[model samples]
Target: MSATPSRYCHLIDEGEVFLERCRRILGEIQAAEDDLSAMTTSPRGRLRVGLAFAAGLPLPVISAFMERYPEIQLDLDFTDRMVDVIDEGFDVVIRGSELKDSRLMSRPLGPYRSCLVASPVYLQNRGIPAKPADLLTHSCLHYRWQNSGKLYQWPFKKQQAIQAGESLPVTMVCSNVEALIYLAQAGRGIACVPDFAVKDSLADGRLDKVLTNSLIGGSTFHVVWPSSRQMAPKVRAFVDFAVENFSKGLVS
Candidate 1:
């Protein structure tokens, strides 16, 4: 029996209807995918960070960033000992000075100055040393790097030349910055440390700056992360926020 033309027309109409439904479903799927992509790229995750104790100046920067990106969870590990950010599983790291590592990318957050300081009680008890050479006579607090085999040398400026040869008479040597700073605050001995760490104490008369004109060396604070983290939304947001706040001197 020959097929009717109406039957053929009906089959063609049904095929058209099926194609139209498929196109509609595909459009809906595409729209759903776009929505998912937007959400996936959004900054929302727990961000682990590492920072030196001396780099606490960036706390306000973190606070400001949190205000803008409420979805990111922040975990800050503040310590003086260095850690491999990538290997240690840290998303970001705030270092007190420029990093020389070729594996990581860093942004200049700001510069900081270190000062030789002592408590007034200690200085009063032991006369203030007028020169870097005189620090040899004074009981000086020494900061030891766990990674560096040697004790930190007291770097000083003399005349037009940078002199780092003058090693202080070390009465105390410790790895913890907080402990050493506390001892300095308690009038144990003279200490050379970041100015920001003792800014409050210096202002409140608990600590006094010694050899204000001489500094170890000027170093810039940096926000460092693994180069692989560039595309991470949380890391990107944090880095941008840190640069904005720190560079403007708004946070620190």
Candidate 2:
């Protein structure tokens, strides 16, 4: 084969780059021109959503939504592990962790609340505490953060002052909310848990809330999704639904 001239090779390279630039410019123009009315007009399509189970199950709300919008199919993933939204093609995720991915858009649902609880049996044997400082002497159950390898921080307002991230001794450490509460119920130790996790326990007389005044601050729940030029109708619907319900005191 004959060797191509250097000038022809340079021209070929420049031409390829020029075409690429043109493609990017056209893509931006198309994105800018994308119509949002398409999303507002109709809601139809499969919406893949994920949520942190430890945060609390949203089954009741999601069930109600299914009845309301039968046209939009919902695929729910209830998990503790953080799933990659863009790579996994999830339309939305309910997360308590601060969103680090700038590519994703987030809407704050509300803040979470932490409560200190122990089983009725455990408190009877171990004796009840009068303040947050007394908790240091009692056996406690912990939720070990998967990402940090450390037990999740417990916050408190103590001694007429705010003392957050106060660490205490623990008898057992695990990530599961049910198992943690079960341990507390079995008279193992005091457990610092989300209020939503132990609603049944509180009602059934299995666990009793301790240090109600010594409240712990928690992460805010957020509905996040990959940001795009034109929002999909299903994604928009769910966002709106979540915001409306949360605003009306559906979930605390």
Instruction: State in Å the error of residue 165, model 1.
Output: 9.2
Model 1, span 118-223: residue lDDT tens: 9999999999877777777888898888777467765666472224564457799987766778999998999877767777787789899887776656778899
Off by over 4 Å in 1: 1-40, 158-167, 228-230, 247-252
Tens digits of per-residue lDDT, candidate 2, 1-252, equal: 255687789999999999999999999877756664645568878999988776345766687778878999999887777789999889999887657898999998877678889988889988998887788789988998765677876777645332456657878999888888888888999998877778777888999998888774667778899988788878888988886664333234
User: Best lDDT goes to which candidate?
Assistant: 2
Per-residue error (Å), model 2, residue 158: 8.2
Number of clashing pairs per prediction, in order: 0, 0
The TM-score obtained by model 2 is 0.74
Candidate 1 clashing pairs?
A: none
For model 1 the local lDDT of residue 86 reads: 78
What stretches of model 2 exceed 4 Å from their correct place? 1-33, 157-167, 246-252
Q: Measured by TM-score, how close is model 1 to the native structure? A: 0.72
